[model samples]
Target: MVDELGARFATAGHEIALVGGPVRDILLGRGSKDLDFATSARPEVVERLLAGWANHVWDIGKAFGTIGCRKGEWVLEITTYRSESYDPTSRKPEVSYGDSLEGDLSRRDFAMNAMAVLLPSHQFVDPYGGMEDVANRVIRTPGSPEDSFSDDPLRMMRAARFAAQLDFTPDPAVVAAMEAMADRITIVSAERVRDELIKLVISPQPRKGLDLLVATGLADHVLPELPALQLELDEHHRHKDVYEHSLTVLEQAIDLEPRLGVELPDFVTRFAALIHDIGKPKTRKFEDGGKVTFHHHDVVGAKLAKKRMKALRFSNEQIDQVGKLVELHLRFHGYGTGEWTDSAVRRYVRDAGDLLSRLHVLTRADSTTRNKRKAEALRSAYDDLEERIARLQEQEELDSIRPDLDGNQIME
Candidate 1:
């Protein structure tokens, strides 16, 4: 089918190449059914060419010089050679079609994504040594890093995304550029930043990406709460380093996803884990003996998480779920000695509602204490709590537990 489509463009006297990330993926042996092709043909011409051939075609990206179509099971986005640049004060880019494939490739965010394969003949094109960078598992820009990031500050976030997705390291120069231009990310839309963040969080190595974001000061602007975790200081190293601890909790939560029956890329769970302790810095109290206490941090953190999620343009449902998780993350600590009554167990299930499983995962992951005995005791207590919940659930359907009377009945 690819060959057929390639032949169609070749016969029409247009130059087309499978380009950008798709080409990079092909080289990485992770061939994708979602193909991106750069063509000398304009959007309209590309639409006309795909009319009879594709099973369906859509103009979702037409304004951006891209024409989308699906042929059989394969989805393809055919785009004209185009360059997009952003005005320094503008949140959006002004797009202009380019005349050459190399020119279009030059505007891509990363060197690994700057390669292409000329269609019909299947010749490879790597004008900026992208193949070498990909082979070395290094992230770099096709041109000057400053110019590339200045053209689109979102690429700074994309660097973190790629780092997470591919587990690749950015070149020192690229890292420096990101550090220098970190504040420029504010010019990009919150929605775009949120999307990049979603990608990074769901990637297999989210910790690595998040570390880069913090190290480069990108987190300071994009997620101030994250870097704020660094302020959770302990002079003697007695306390768990809250910033690193939160990241460790995120890793542990990701590992628990499959066992806990969470869907992969569960944003709510991961975000909850990462932001669960954000309130500690705000609630810290120093005692006479230098002990730090964070009373009611769960409640404070939940409110802060909601505010941050709203700023990042998260959906209301996502905000609510993550906020609830953050608020409830500390509740399990109160279930000491497994002495709760059946009513208390029901209340626990009721408070958790549909998020009980995720709450369980978060509560467990939150135990980053260094003492093995304490860790084992916490795990054992949680195991006992789970058993009690299961037994109660079997006997009385704890998931559907409710008040014996409706609001109207109580009023009467």
Candidate 2:
């Protein structure tokens, strides 16, 4: 595909290069179906060239110098070499076509993504030392960190997302710039920030990216609840750190996904685990003997999670799923040593409904206690619960259970 497209463009006296993420992924030996290219040809010319060659073509981003097409199994986005600048208060960027691939690459978010492969000729271009940065496993902007982020403050979040996606560390200067300019993220639309956050949360190494966000104060604007997990230290009480425990739970939930039949990159489960205890800080109370308790934190957390997700413009389905998970994450604790009767088990299954499988994983992952005896006890109790649920499922068809009559039936 690359050779054919490049040959066609070259023959037409236009320049084309496989640019940005596709180029970066190629160097890292990662396979990607999405191909991004930069061309010296204008959008119209690019569209003209792609005619009939592409199985399908679209111009949703034509104004931004981007034309998308698909050929065979490859999804391609061919964009004219462009430079974009954002107004201080606007969420959108004003894009202008550039004349050179180097100039286009220079404006990218990271040096690692700034490399390109000049198509047809197959020449590798690394004017910004992107190859070295990729080899070193570090992230740096093509230009100054400040300039790169100012062009599109969402790039700040992208830095974190890439860190999570690639398992690469940002350079100190990048981190410092993020810390200095964290407030700039507020100007970017909530939808963009939320999308970046979802990518980070679903990545293989979410904790690394999340930690950077918290460390750099980016979370302060985008997700205040995450940093607020660091509740005021009560030296005397000395309970497990809620913030650290949440991260551990997220990792454990991800680890349990395959075993429990939840799909990989289950953002609902992962996000629920991360925010399940967000209400702890809000509900913290000291008893007479200095024992700390977060009474009704599950219920409180459910509301908080829904509210925050709503603000981020998440879909109604996503909001409801995560909210319900947060609310039920603590329900298993009541079944001490499998003491629940058949009725109790039925209610448990009924309450969980479609979320039962995920609930199982979330409840199991929530047991992050270091105490071997307690952890074993929780696991055994859950094992018993699952076994009972399975038996009941066989005997009673608990999965399809419902009220005998609906509201309309009752009315009739």
Candidate 3:
């Protein structure tokens, strides 16, 4: 579908380039199949040109000058050069068409993405020194940082995501702009915020991206729970601030296995790590000797996670998975002791069910601490518990511990 559309656009005498991440990734020697095209042709003309070659065409964002073409398993997006201005109260843009590719590139969110390549000839066009920015490992917005983020607050999240994904530092001015306009993020849709966050958390340097979010004050607007988790206790008896600990867990989770062949994307696990300890603030208590503990924080955190997921308009399945992971995140660490009873393992397996492995990953991440011995001990215990669960399953004890009673089965 990409080839067909590319050919059609090329033949139409319109300058089209397979642009954005696809070209950027190719230059960076990374794999990317998502194709995007930038052209001087108007959106309507591009639509008409693609209609002949593409059997499946949809104007998914025609107002923003985007049209999608699909042929079999491949899909390509063709967009015209355009510029936009945003209302102060909404992320939705008021658009204006641009005569030159430079105008369009100038309006893009990041310098790396602002670069383009000409189709057929494969010549690169970089007006904003995006290639240089990519080479320098820096993320900079096209034109002014304030104008870029003010036009779309979601760009702040995108900055963090690109930083995480590309292992680049955002320009200091851009970071300051993000901090100043953090409250403007509320104008963006929850779904867009969630999408960017998912990408950020899934990236290799997820903790870096999250730290940036907190540092820039963006989390206070989009994820209030995170900043609230930063509340301090009176003494050393308290654990680390929940917000800092959450980032630590996220880093540790990625460091532990680094790879899980689960069907869900890496971002989901990252998101779970970010919110796993959310209940701690609400559950905090001061005992004798200034000892601070969060009793039943997992249970409370699960409920808070669900609310956060809902606020972000996450899918029902995603919300449930994140919530479940938050609720049982602590179960694996203590499983090697008396908690390793056959019945306990069965219940653990049953509670976690399809998410058992992911929960283990989360638990491993959650055990982050300064004490090397404790960390090693937790890892050892978790290993033993996993082996014990396997042995129990082999004995068929797990299979027989169904929740369905004999009377209920007979009634059915």
Candidate 4:
């Protein structure tokens, strides 16, 4: 299928090459199913050629010169050389086609993604030393980082995402550019920002991406709640800063559950991890004795998470799951310390409902602290709680715990 597509593009007097993530992954010796091809040919030409051989062809982004062609289970994305210019307010770009491969490479978001390979010959083209950056596990822009990022502030998030995904660091210049242009991210749509955030949180090392967000000042613009979480009391409480603690929680979540299968449940867990402590800022209080307390922080955090999710236009199911997770995050800790009563456990089971396992994963992630003994003890308690819940479930004790208990039956 690849060969046939290659031949079709080749016969049209255009140089077609596998590019972007597919090429990057292939060079890194990783398996990639999404195939993307860069072509010197125009979008229309590419579409016409693919239409003859492929069963399905779509102009997913024809205005920006992209065409999607599918053959059976295999899908290929083809795009002509293009450059984009953005208005100050919206992330949607004003795109124009370029005539050469250099133009396309120059316009890419990162050096690692800029690298392309000739399809038939399988020869890599690294115009901006993308190959060297990829080999060294660095993420740099193709040209001036300032110009590249200014053209699209969302690239700042993408840079962090690549760092997390590839376990690389952004070039110093790129990092500086990201910091300088952090506020500009507000101009981008919340949906675009959310998508990038999701990708970063799901990466192998989510902390790397999140740290970059905090460091680059993007967090202040994208998620101002984080900075609010950083406020500290004098010396009363030794709890870590809320932002740092959240990152720790995210790292722990990724560690505890490395692979969350592609589904709504997985995304909910990740989103919950990111916003689990969101209420701390709103609930913070300093007592007369200098004791710092975040009373009802979980409830406040859940409210904040709902607002943020709504701003991002998350699906209703996703919003509900994340909000529920944030609200009940502190429940497991309470269960660990207090009585694991049947009523209490039943309440948890009812609240969690279909999301019990996901909630458990979130609880495990939330146990990150400097106190190793405390953490371990909590883990053991959690395991016991799980066992108890399982036994209760097996005995059908929870079956009748539903809210629709029969007042009519009682009357009868």
Off by over 4 Å in 4: 258-265, 336-338, 397-412
The alpha-carbon RMSD values of the candidates against the true structure, listed in the order shown, are: 4.4, 4.6, 4.6, 4.3
Instruction: List the candidate 2 regions with Cα displacement exceeding 4 Å.
Output: 260-262, 398-412
Residue 255, candidate 3: C-alpha displacement in angstroms: 3.6
- The alpha-carbon lDDT assigned to residue 266 of candidate 1 equals 89
Compute each candidate's TM-score over C-alphas. 0.94, 0.94, 0.87, 0.89
Rank list by lDDT: 2, 1, 3, 4
- Candidate 1 vs candidate 3: the TM-score winner is 1
For candidate 2, which ten residues in a row score worst on lDDT?
394-403
Clashing pairs in 3: none
Report the C-alpha lDDT of model 2 over 195-240, residue by residue, as the tens digit: 9999999999999999999999999999999999987667784776
Tens-place lDDT per residue, model 3, 375-400, is: 89887887777787788777786567
Error of 3 at 271 (Å): 2.0
Instruction: At residue 56, give the lDDT of candidate 3.
Output: 82
Tens-digit lDDT track for model 4 on 180-218?
889988888888988998888777777788788888899
lDDT of 1 by residue, 1-412 (tens): 8788889998999999988888889778886667899999999999999998999999968889989999888898899998776777875779899889989898888888989898888998999898998899999998889888887889999999999998889999999999999999998999999999999998899998999999999999999999899864568655667898899999999988876675677888999999999999899888877788898999999999999999999999999999999999998888876688888888889999999999998998986577899999998988988899999888776536766888899899
Cα error, candidate 2, residue 118 (Å)? 0.7
The deviation in Å at residue 6 for candidate 2 is 0.7
Tell me model 3's lDDT, rounded to 2 decimals.
Answer: 0.82
